[model samples]
Target: MCRHVVPASASRKALLLQALLLISAGMVGTWCVQAITIETVNKASEVMCVRYWIPNEVGGGCNEVRMGNKWDIQVTDRWKAATVWATEGGCGGAHCNTGPPTGVTQFEITVDGGWSNDYYDISALAGFNLGLTVAPTNPTCASQICTSLSTCQGVVPGGPDRTKACKYGSASYVLTFIK
Candidate 1:
């Protein structure tokens, strides 16, 4: 009986291992670059709420306020301090359905100038007003809208003294992704 055998080459083994190492190193290097290049829109976010128009009630009120689509003030073209109304049920998935008979849908956008730049703080929202910190954060592209409508904080009303608890002085948006 006769048997045939194939010879193993040492150079071939070394070359195969070198190729694998190069590929692994390249993958690691790509991930590192992507990690450092990723960023978000300066803590900006939106909430969803349904509007309710009741029947025959005074002071912007109605008799039977039924639930409407979720909505709130939305920011668009954050540059030049721009924003507008974003339709309800379109806030993506961050909106919470808080049952029926809802009167207001609150969408809040918080800018992170520093730790102190908050939205809920009444005093801060009323004072030291600053423009937005992002661009094209969002846009519906319909009517030319005013930036005032999209802000949780508005200009201080002129009068003797009237304080509302709707200050947006301490809100910020942050998201995390796993890859």
Candidate 2:
């Protein structure tokens, strides 16, 4: 029986081709995890209650954000949506809810997972308890801001208006709660 051997040049070429294919298929060099940092700022005159959670997970409950302070949530390479609420009162209060209910301001964000673009929006459809603004670090991405309850769009029966999107791994965001 005779044994067959591959030449060094041919082996290298084959390996290079395999690598290129993997990269193109988004398998090789795709482990570069990108993150979007969402900074929630409390510009209200009093302490604000905040709650946040990703899809299929329960939030840690209402956390108080002191006036002029900020809370940051970093979303890494995950294909889930993160929802945050800023309310005048804590959870179980007259003004807040564990979920996005009426009278609670909500900010929803879906970070890029290397395959799709990032989407973000501020919704007053639940009724406005606080003014909200979602500003992305990328200038190319537009900001979603609603500063007045009367001027703010109410429930559209579906979703928020003026949803903004940015390139994958492009920008972090700042969600500000104004007075």
Name the best candidate (by TM-score). 2
lDDT, residue 12, candidate 1? 75
Cα RMSD for predicted model 2: 8.5
TM agreement with the true structure for every prediction: 0.17, 0.70
Model 1: per-residue Cα lDDT over 38-147, one tens digit each: 01221112322222121222211111111331122222112121111122222344323221222222222223223423121111223222222222212321111113
Clash count list over all predictions: 17, 0
Please, what are the lDDT tens digits per residue for candidate 2 over residues 74-146? 6675636667877774444543334565777788777763347887777666677878877889899887767
lDDT at residue 102 of model 1 (Cα atoms): 21
Candidate 2: stretches off by over 4 Å: 1-29, 58-62, 89-98, 113-115, 153-161
Colliding residue pairs in candidate 2: none
Report residue 100 deviation for candidate 2 (angstroms): 3.0
